[model samples]
Target: MTPPRNVHARAALLMLGSTLGFGLMAIFIRLASKDIPTWEVAFFRNAFGFLSLLPMLALPALRQPRPAAAFAASVRTDQLPRYVIRTAIGIASMFCGFWAIAHLPLAQAISLAYSSPIFVTIAAILMLGERVRARRWTAVALGFVGVLVIVRPWSHAFSLGSLVAVAAAVLSALVAIQIKQLSQTDKADTIVFWTYALWVPMSLLPSLFVWRWPAGIEWLWLAATGLMGTVGQLLWTRALKLGDVSALTPISFMQLPVVTLAGWLLFGESVDGATLLGAGIILGSTFYIAHREAKLAREQRSKAPSEAVEPGS
Candidate 1:
């Protein structure tokens, strides 16, 4: 077995890889947006992303002998409703996110999107009836403060694109909650496969209304966006599989700097002080929440055997 430290190192590296892939995906999305409608970009992103998975789906058959079983295992007919809802919400999230990225500075858009964890906490309380202790509540409060700082309402800095980005974050949080629920009954691969399968059609519906042919280089950018997204998801899943989520969670913040640099170099975008401050506050709160959850999980595991033992052994 791998040592715990090595496992953590590997997970961290995988997370870095995931962040880089996602950052590049954002860059490509921005690039494609220059020549195509946001809806068209969304459609091609999902379509090509689904196509990218075809080789991986077939690889199991090439290595082993059971092609039919490999293909069948990827689909879960019983979970159609859940998959549909997830994809529907995901399509909305992508449309809003693509539009936001296309209009706003890349780093600003990314920081705003990272606010999903804050919304996820709120969703758990309202939807799942999950109890929030005082510290978590405080963290949630500070997270919102961070968001306000970034948005800076009543200021010239805020725009419709900023609100759209926040909406995307909320939608993304809803999808995250749905994925958590689905995880109780579905294998990770099955969930991923269904996302692409359902998303391809749902995302296409919006594109149909605003269709435009990609002009030469736009096609390449669109393909890169799709490929990057798929690779990023795979790397993120592998990182979680390899190590503790709490330990790996912070590594994702690496994307902020990566995207910031990409935006500066590629698009002449600069990060302002307020945006940096807000991102720091938001990330700090989320990190605290993650740490607390990990600590509580550890405490529960430590007590499990004692609680399970008979009163008088």
Candidate 2:
């Protein structure tokens, strides 16, 4: 058996690999956007992602005693409503995110999207009725301040792309909350498989209005984006299975720097001083929030065994 320490190290590395895959996906999105419309790009992304996941779905079927039943079980019909809602939200988020990536600097678009964790925290309070203590509230406040710093609303620095990116973050938070609820009754694979299955058709509708077949290397980038996205999702899930979420959460921030470096090297995009400062502040708040949540989870787990014992015993 693998040592606990080794498991953690492997998880951390998987998380890093996941981040790298995401960074590459962003780059490919940018590259493909040059020739393809954002709507079409979104469609291809979901379509190709769904196609790439077929092998995963098929592999399970081959190993099961009842292949047909196993295949059907992978997509639970009872959960279709929730999956539809989740996929709709995810499609909207993807459309907005792709548009922002097409219009804004890679770093700026990614930085704005990073605000999803803050939105998720707020959503948990309002939608899920989860209580937030003062420290987390403080972190939320700092996160908003960081957003203002990056956006500079009163100045000319603000643009529609920034607003769209923030909208995407909000939608993404909603998706995250939905996933939290779904995880209670469904497996992760079911959730992912259904989302991609549903998303392909939903994304295709809007894409028809803007449809233009990709030519030349455009096909390569679009396919790469989908493949990278699917691979990244797999890595992220594996990482969570192997390590504590808190240990992996901080590692995700590594994507911003990786993207920033890619932006500089590939596109000659330079991040402004204020943008960098704001990103740092936002990341710091997110890190704190994740750390606090992890600490609380650890405490709860530690107490569970003791609480289970009889008082007399």
- Pairs in clash, predicted candidate 2: none
lDDT of each: 0.86, 0.87
lDDT of each residue in 111-154, candidate 2, tens digit only:
88888889999998888877788888899899998888888898
The window of 10 residues in a row where model 1 has the poorest summed lDDT is: 304-313
Top-lDDT candidate index? 2
Model 1 residue 2 CA deviation in Å: 9.5
TM-score for candidate 2, please give it. Answer: 0.94
Model 1, 188: alpha-carbon shift in Å?
0.5
What digit string (tens of lDDT, one per residue) describes model 1 on residues 1-313? 4457878888899998998899889999999999799999998998899899878866766665777775786555588887998989999999999998999998889998888888988887777767678888888889889989999997998777799999999999999889988888887878888899888888888788889888888999999999999999999999988876778778889888988898999999999998999999888888877776666766666779767421110
- Clash pairs, candidate 1, are none
Candidate 1: C-alpha lDDT: 0.86
How many residue pairs clash in model 2?
0
Off by over 4 Å in 1: 1-3, 61-64, 304-313
